[model samples]
Target: MAADDGVVLDEGAVVLEDAPPSNLDKLENSPPSNLDKFLKRFRALNPHFVRDDAEKLVCFFGDSDISHWKELPRVRITGDEGASWARCVNVGVGGAEMLHVAFYSAECRAKYRPDVVVLCAGENDLGAGAAPPTVFSYLEKSIAAFGHLDDATEQAQLRLRHDPQRTRDNANVVSSLPIDDTKSQQQDGMNASEFSRLRNNNTDEKVPIVYLCTKPEPVADAELRREYERYDGRIKELFQRYNSSCQEELLYFIDNSDLRDPSLYAQDGLHLSRQGYQVWDARVRDAVERVLLKMDERVLAP
Candidate 1:
């Protein structure tokens, strides 16, 4: 157990002594970054900026449910096969809780510059005996890490971006803009035109985060599932509040159907089976399609 740091969080939130250290030096040895290894592998896979038809990145992160999903790029983006499509990577760690995601939230965005991020965690947090309060704290931290903008400020930025005076001379600011899709995107070896697309004045996009609610699992009994459901509701309510603050149209959820369908689970009654992954993959791809397609419409619209 971690020693108390002598602090408490919000009403439902609690601070853990063993939580990932915020200091740069203490972090050299203490709690190790689990995502660091995985990110290295991903960066190596994508040696250079993807100038291929795959123009956008859609990242998926979570526990085994997300880690196990191995989807390829089959979803087409437009009539022109030459147009850019979505590239995806699953940065899930098998036993990760929302704490891991919260701690590494900024790095997650920096690495991929993903246009869309689908997050499916917290199941293991509940499974590992974390109470609803703990999960809420985890979620609050994760959402805040994304730098959620106040509605008024966000709207003001959007309005300003759309204003003719501001957008009419994108060429002028293009040379001066510090960051957009990401500082890393430019650093990743993309040229000037590539960086400019990220600042596309049309969407005012902010790498929307998609929230995937914890699904009912057969490994958990009815009572446990009920507890999971209750926790899910609370965490989802929290997610929606944060998601609502800065979200585009992105919801192709699996909880829409009978959640306990055994066909979805493998023989282990926990990890998803081939059929289950198919269902999840399709829904995720559909969500990605909607977001990208909408952005296309927004850009093309008069």
Candidate 2:
């Protein structure tokens, strides 16, 4: 059965009968051992803290969910064994679109001077009924802004010339636009091929990475399920174009679309659950590690 809020419920509460148990649950249920207490204290004192000797600085720019996720990417990366050497700065603004994200990223870059920028926005733009060109243009502008390219002059010219190389050199990693089950119509505003063209046309040197987080399957609402079925193929096609066009070194695609497990999602069915964010955290951490390793190699080559 479903709740008045449209959340699927089994008996009295929302439950995940078919999903595997999450590690978070184990941590929650187990008594706090000495080591667990120590770790908990350490995390409480400095949840988003990075060591002074950290190798790289990562900045995240995205929507409200990115800002408020149970574990922000920065905190997750800081705690990761492989990625602990990196520092993180999160500048995610709730309810932001590509345009707002670009502006904030530019501001954050000036202050933090991050070596890597991860973008997890654009859904709001689609929700707002923006056209494909409009959405793409905002993305381009945001990329340029974060790269420290002069916005007023460069953004105008970029639309005409559309230099993909400039963006590629900026050390930006953009997450692909995910499919939202709630939206009946296409949220991306553009078709897959056109989106592909816009993205490919702007590339050149291939240093920046594109991370694709696939949408979840099995939306509970029948109406929403129908909507997802209609758009899922096109979303997959867009992701394919992004992955196929880029060198393996420059693209990191996380295919969660086949994930039908309701436990991975929040009550809304649109956002990710704590477990889902954990999945994202691991993938993004790996991608950032690869980028940092490649960068280190480049620096040491000379």
Candidate 3:
């Protein structure tokens, strides 16, 4: 349970703003035309079925934090030197972990044919009591699953976008193991170090680039906070390894733990507030620009 300040709503309901009628009931009762427009916009923001004709397609895959990107106003993607660039597509699903993200990655590659994919996961696996090796394996597998596919199969999947009846499977694999709320705090920092060493030695590159976001520290009960801090530390360490690894500049990590200000969090202390989403949008835009610049530079160098 979150603190009183956290955003709390009934199951199957989403709070778009800090006001009345935050439930889906209002949407359900709206006129057909209004509902059609709303659904169209929602589908546009979350393009799981069809692919837009954007020159540069970027897909964001993760949990609630990634899903919240839809709440932010669109921002121009200016490169590192302020030259405008590409737009992004959000394929986030709340409560998703690496397993779910991996599945979605395949779908995004086949349908959207994204030029870049941002993966934000692992924290939930850590919170769910997954061992460090297990977590690392999941991350590696997810990245690998996004690797190049056969041309014919890829084209077939891409053509499916034209089929109006084509639908996406939303099922996810859930772990039944009880969460170890305090287990992270009990371990020495050695696990993070080992994970970092293993990750750096792999020198793996699965896609053009995989933008990873470090887990933010949770602002909840004392026990949960401690565990989150430990998990966050591991993420930072893993990011450092990613930077030092000899792989191509195909994996970039962004640290967003600083955005943990109380005012930026909803009552649940898990999701972001509207203001928080704005801040996140700015950071993500900057990172995307940097990546685009690097890609351009690499292309022009030869």
Write down the TM-score for model 3: 0.58
lDDT of 1 by residue, 167-216 (tens): 21211121122222332233443334432322323335355566666665
lDDT of 1: 0.51
**Deviating ranges (above 4 Å) for candidate 1:** 1-54, 79-84, 147-205, 238-257
Off by over 4 Å in 2: 1-54, 73-84, 148-256
Best by lDDT: 1
Query: Taking the tens digit of each residue's C-alpha lDDT, what string does model 2 give over 1-302?
Result: 12223433221111212211122233235522332332232223324554343456776656654665645554323323553456665555455554455444455545556666666655444444333334444454555554322323324211212123422211122223233234423333444444344343333323343333325433444433333332322323333444464433443344445556788777676567788778778777777777777666655666
Error of 1 at 268 (Å): 1.7
Clashing residue pairs, candidate 1? none
Q: Write the per-residue lDDT of candidate 3 for residues 221-286, one digit (tens) a residue.
A: 454444444343333433444445534555665656466677787766667777877776777667
Scored by Cα lDDT, where does model 2 land?
0.45
Q: How would the candidate models be sorted by TM-score, starting from the highest?
A: 1, 3, 2
**Cα lDDT listed for each candidate:** 0.51, 0.45, 0.48
Ranking by lDDT: 1, 3, 2
Please give each candidate's TM-score.
Answer: 0.61, 0.53, 0.58
* Pairs of residues at least 3 apart in sequence or in different chains that clash in candidate 2: 64-94, 164-202, 164-203
Give the C-alpha lDDT of model 3. Answer: 0.48
TM-score of 1: 0.61
